[model samples]
Target: MKNIRNFCIIAHIDHGKSTLADRLLDYTGSVTEREKQNQLLDSMDLERERGITIKSHAIQMDYIYKGEEYVLNLIDTPGHVDFSYEVSRSIAACEGALLIVDAAQSIQAQTISNLYLALENDLEIIPVLNKVDLPSANPEEVTDDIVELLGCNPEDVIHASGKTGFGVDKILEAVIERIPAPKGDPDGPLQALIFDSVYNTFRGIETYFRVFNGEIKKGQKIKFVATDKEYFADEVGTLKLTQVAKKSVKTGDVGYLITGIKTAKEVKVGDTITDFERPTTNIVEGFEDVKPMVFAGIYPVDTEDYEELRNSMEKLQLNDASLVFFPESSAALGFGFRCGFLGMLHMEIIQERLEREFDMTVITTVPNVSYNAYTNKNPDTPFIVNNPSDLPDPSTVNRVEEPYIKATIITKADFVGNVMSLCIEKRGMILNQTYLTPERVELTFDMPLAEIVFDFYDRLKTVSKGYASFDYHPIGMKTSKLVRLDILLNAQTVDALSALIHADNAQNIGKKMCEKLKELIPRQQFDIPIQAAIGAKIISRETIKALRKDVTAKCYGGDISRKRKLLEKQKKGKKRMRQVGNVEIPQQAFMAVLKLND
Candidate 1:
């Protein structure tokens, strides 16, 4: 156990954490030249194409240092803010973290956020400056910044380049010398922390865990502390890039357990696993259930694919315990699921995975943040509403509270003014601003999460010329003047198109939505009226004119009375059609309205 090191790599997106992981694998001889691949830990195709880590992966490596064999457990974590929960879980499984920062880009928003998470976990942090191979790299200045921010010794910061394999040996030596080995009792009762899990079609639930006490072996009966369900360990193994069956996994070691439980509901992340017969009285602490922050409705393009979508979501939930969903029905969208996510990116990844992995076409409604609505009569009993359509009558509601987030943005100093302007437009309150370096600045703001969800990041990027990086965490709910904005297509309310907006910006947003809808909705046999309304009052309106037809074209020599009669008949027919016909809105129209930020 003294020679064992359990640690993870933490960094902002595109900081080369995966690249560093690949180089470490090579240095440890975990993968041979023939099998080496870029971003090996990112097994999902989407992850490689997008150049980001969407999931956390763990692997065991055997390294030799000074003629002594050492066991190293490397857990590679996602860098995106949307997967912060995953990062926390990964941090919980390790005793230390490698805080990697790009030498050329310096510190980023996620870099600071991830550093705080590592500190909160009480893990030893090794500051490593990466990308020194770039021509613009400035390792010295970056090391100084790290030392100032983290208050670490100047000599402690390691300068390395993951792309060029420079300082790889030094990093390994630091991991062996600085990071502490896992401490536990081998003779104690079996106690393991389940950090992650995945569903296998042939083997059922495969759970990844770190053994904190005692040992686990094949055929041993173990129970999940949270579920209180017991199952015989059908297989026990360690991951070596791939799973390799083992005789036993002892204390201070990380591995996977295959219990023949056929359903995903039986396995839960952050749950403790212990011996069934000799169970420990104390369960592992800090095992909180994942709570989703954003909600959206996802429906299959074809109604018949509903069952398949449900099954796919179930399978997806097996790996992603953070995802929450239940059955939902929309008159316009048919049967679907009301799904909750940690953030917008999390929602996009799930939607993409459902289509890519499950081969199902789906339509997702506009994303929304959960709100608290208090009734005038029952002010003490506020109801949580996930969908705008679920909001109570405006006259009966006393107040509304919307979710807000503490956003941290880091960018070039020249772009600070632009960033501030963008934040103010999104109703953000400046909390603090500090110059990290002469050329870089960090700004903190308290902004409504709903405002940031709609094209805020894109606008920030445009204003900063792609130099700004952002990360945010939910602070709490704040009382606000908010209202439910409804879209009326031909005077009929479309439930899926309804949104919750601040009252001050309601008029402008409604107008933009109406204009976008007019451009998206095609002309029909009758004129279709697009309207945006708040409560009983219509605030904005646009009309898509009906396709015109020459009713008197055949009356070349006919009398003016004949032409007038034909035109009158045509007008009456158009009026009747407008009264009886329903406007069919395209799916793109909904997406356009949701993306209307300009």
Candidate 2:
């Protein structure tokens, strides 16, 4: 334990955290020259393509300094706000963190959010200025910003270039000298914190954990404190990019436990694992389950793929516990699953993976934030509705509360006005503003999650010229004048196109939705009427005119009575078709409203 140092790297997206992890692995000889690759810690192809880390990874490295051998356990975490929970779990298992900041970009919204998470975990933070080799690098300014934000000594900041492998050794030396060794009682009853887990077909559920007390060995019976399920350990090992088998893992050690448990549901992230027979009396603290904030319905393009989609989702959920889903049926789209996600990016990633990984084409409805709806007769029992179609009647609803987030945006001073205008336009209430530097400013607002979940990020990027960064966290529910807007096609309500919207913007939203639907829905034999309504009152309407057939074109030089009879017959047929015709709404039509804010 005295020679072990557990630390993780935290940074904003595209801040070179993965690059630094690669450099450390190269310097420690964990991966040979033949095996080294860019972003070595990022295993997913999507992660490499996007140049971002999506999953947190842990590896063990051995290094010798000053004739003393030290074992370093390094965990690389995702920098996006969507995976902030993964960062928190990584921080809980580490004693220190290397806070990486881009030298050119300096501090960002996610950088500050990650710093707060590290501080909350009471981890020793080592600020590192990365990418100093860039022509636009401003290490001095970044160093000062770090000092001001952390209130640390100016000399404590370390400068490193992840691109050039400069200052890489110095970072390892700092980790050894500054980060304390893990503390635990080796003889006490077994207690381990399961920070992460993966499902293996051959070995079943392989759990990654940090032992707080006692030891875990092969063939030992262990139980999860949360589930109270007992399983015999089939294997014990540490990760060195891949699993390395070991006879036992002692206290204060990070390793994987291969249990015969066949499903990932049995071993949850943040759950406590302890000895089954001689179980510890107290479970480890700070175990909170991840709850998804965004919800959307994903349906297969082909109705017959419903069972296949469910199986694919189940397989994916084994690897991602944060993904929540249940069966849902749509009147227009057929059977599907109403899935919950951490955020927009998470939802997108899941959809992409479902298509690319599972080879299934699926249509995703407009994403929604969970809302609390209270009926007049049951005001005390406010029910949660994730789908607008599930909401009760507007006349019966006494009030509606939507989830709000405390949003933080960092941008150049010149773009502050644009950012503020965009926020206010989204119904955000300004909380406060502070100038981080003479040229940079930070703005805080209490914004509805629904307003920003769709297109606010893209708008902010466009308005700020891609120089602004944003981060948000849930701050609870806020009561507002909210109403469910329904789209009607040929006088029939389409449940999939329904949405919860603010009452003030209902008219405009209804108009835009009707226009978009008219553009997307194809013309039929009869005019297809598209209407947007609030309750029973129609607020906006548009019609897709039927294609003209030139009924009189064939009657060249014919009698006027013949043309008249043809016209009357055509009109009668049109009337009959309008009574029995069903408007065939394409999948794109159901998704057209999502682009309204865009």
Candidate 3:
């Protein structure tokens, strides 16, 4: 086991973690020159388009160190806080973490948060300062910051520019040295962790697991400790490391296996897979259970494609375990699913993936957190609401509290004042401040998770000119003066996109949201009066003028098919819209309103 090193690359979003993974795959000769792929770890189209690691990817590479063959099992973790749960699941499959911090940017809030998660898991961390080739590189200072922030020896840091391949060998050497090899009774029962899975049209479902003890080979029967479902391992394979296909996987390896599991319900991420014959009494734990904090409803643009949407969601669930969905029935829209996610970004990523990969359009509801409404009829019963329509009566909600996050923003010294002012404006409470470098400072704050889930990051980036970096983790619920702002279209609630905002800024925020919605939703067949109000008082209003004409005059017989096709396309376009009694709203309207300034 000492010859095998399991590790994950951890970093904040856009800090070059995926790029480093690509370079490592190249240096290890995992990708042949003939079959080179750019950003090989980002297999999903959405991931490549967003330039973010939405799903964690695992790859195995054989590296020769000091004339000895060592297998380096690499896992790429999501850097965004929205998928922190996915990051945790990925971290569970590894024995150590390669802390990748950008040399030019220094330590970020996410860097610190991920470092703490690694420490909490008791995983060895090999610090790597990446992007050293940049002119603004400050490896030495960042190393010192790492030492100060984590109180760990700076000796573990390996200065290397993943782009230039500098110190790549040294980083590899440090992985074997700093990260301890897998230690378990290989001869005993086979216990593995199901960190992730994927479904193939031909092969059915393939689950990725890291064996904690014992050897699992092809044709061996295994049982999931949690589900008690048994299946034979038809094939054992490792990640191609540079491609999306499966290679040869073995013991003490981080890879996947085909067990002929059909539906995604049989095997779930974070479940325990074990040898059925061995029957170990003690099972290895995977990761903390990830709960979806934000909830929303998703409906197809065309109600006829609802089944296809469900099938797509099931396929997506094979790779993404954090996204959750349940059947929902709405009067305005037909049968749909109420989906839950980590945050707003997670919600958007899922919605976009469904549209792009499955070739289907969907109308998504506004994201809302679960709240416990106090009432005499059901005082003890906790009610979960996704759409504003599901919200209990305001009088029944004795006191409303929403989840908050302990946020930290790191930026250049020059923008500190402006950033602080913005934070305060969002009702953020300053927690602590420290110098990451002479020119950079890390400011910690206690802000509502809802605040950062919106345009806070974009605003931060805009204010700092894309120089500011931020990360946050849920800090539990906190009481706030919050109210539900119902978005009405012609005096009727557009149940698809209602927002709960703080009473103090509800007017201003609602105005901004309605304005963005007006811009996002194109002119409809009828003029739509978009209005935002709290209870009986109106705050903001915008009108989407009626569409004059969306079709052109043509021959009745010759152009019938073409004109009918165009009308059909227009009708299909309307199917993608959400009809709120008398008004029609597009899917992007909800997303654009949530991220108004972005």
Candidate 4:
């Protein structure tokens, strides 16, 4: 236990954190030849599909250095900005961090941001230059930059290509040397930080924590500081990188222990676990409650799949603490849930999972930021609205404030004019600009978070010819003249299609939205009036003309089976739509309107 080192791996997206984790498990022989896998830390299908780490994963390894076996606990963290909260939780669980920086990309905005989080936690950091095998790799320059930024000796930086297994042994050596051994009173009462949790089918809820102090054993009653619930531990086990090995873990060991508690509701992430027999007086601060930044409606394509959707969401929530959902009902779509997420990527991943994993198609509404509304008459009362339809009356909402972000764009100097122009068009104000290099420039802008919620980044790439990059942090709330624009198909609110837009852009934005809706939604059997409006007055309207004859004229009784098959096909087509009075609107129609640049 004296030689045990517990640490986490942190880096920006695509910085090879998962790849490096795989190499570490391999070098330590934690994963054998038959069990070797790609991107070992990315265990979820969604993570693999999106090529991003969405959850924090841990693996324990025993590395023999100089004929001495040392237990190494490596926690792999998500690199995306949306999941930074999870990164913070994982960082809190470990005593040290291995900050991986890409050799070619040098230090990116996210890399710097996450590095600061690690430093703020006062965790020991061993800077590493990854992707050393790339043709354009500049390990020496990156090493120098890291030294200047992190205040570390350039010579102390570890150079390695996680893909090629180069210098992996050296990284292990550095972890053992630089990362401090876990220091806690092994004889004292148990105290641990609940960094992560997962719902187990057999064991109920399995909480993963690092024993910072004292020893823990099976059958001991424990107390979670956050929940104040006491439960007897059924088992204590360690991850052998691939499979759970049943063993008695002690202080400084990174492992998952099972209790009788069965659901995520019982074992909350960021809770502290302690011995109930002799409770400690000191209380460690739990992680801040993360609020979902983006909200959207999610419903099953088939109304009957509602139960499956709920179960699937519960299963996902077991591992992902970031996903939040509540019951929601739609007139056309039936029962579903209003799911909240950290960002657009997080929302998309959940929707895709419903289709792929659960075999249930989902109709999602436009994503919107949470808003606080104040009525002039009731100045003391504040109303929170997540759905645009739930917004207080336009006249009643005297003042509305939406979240804003300080956005930074790093791109070639040649595209500065184009980038600035687009920013202004999106109602973004330029804050600052600096040149990282003669050809590379960084532009800072104060932008409304709603403007870039959808395909704004894609448009930026188009304007900058794929040479531009974007990063942003919330700069707090700002007053805006925003209004909810509801789409009505013959006098009924199409719950699947609602958007919040700046009052100034309402008419034009509504027109573009109607056009996109017309393109994505199939024409119904009867003519449907697609209109977008603020309150009762309609500003933009488009007609989805009724289908002249979607069905064949033959076979009422003759060839009945063939006729039935044809009708089934036509029904399949109509199933793609959310039928409101005389109109069937496809799900894509809702998403298309959200990106209507027309």
The TM-score obtained by model 4 is 0.90
In candidate 1, how many Å is residue 594 off? 2.8
Q: What does candidate 2's lDDT look like per residue over 179-264, in tens digits?
A: 99999999999999998887666877788999989999999988999988888888999988888999999988899988777755
* Candidate 1, residue 171: how far the Cα is off, in Å: 0.8
Model 1 agreement with the true structure over 248-285: per-residue lDDT tens digits: 99999999999877877788888899999889777776
User: What C-alpha lDDT does candidate 1 achieve relative to the native structure?
Assistant: 0.91
lDDT of 3 by residue, 469-512 (tens): 88777777766777888888767776666777789988988888
Of the candidates numbered 3 and 4, which has the greater TM-score value? 4
Q: Which segments of candidate 3 are over 4 A away from where they belong?
A: 150-155, 242-251, 376-382, 510-529, 537-581
lDDT of each: 0.91, 0.90, 0.79, 0.82
User: Which wins on lDDT, candidate 2 or candidate 4?
Assistant: 2
Q: How does candidate 2 fare on TM-score?
A: 0.96
Q: Estimate candidate 4's RMSD in Å.
A: 6.1
Error of 1 at 416 (Å): 1.2
TM-score of each: 0.97, 0.96, 0.88, 0.90
User: Of models 1 and 4, which has the larger lDDT?
Assistant: 1
* Candidate 1 residue-wise lDDT at 544: 95
Candidate 2: worst-modelled 10 consecutive residues by lDDT: 259-268
lDDT assessment of candidate 4: 0.82
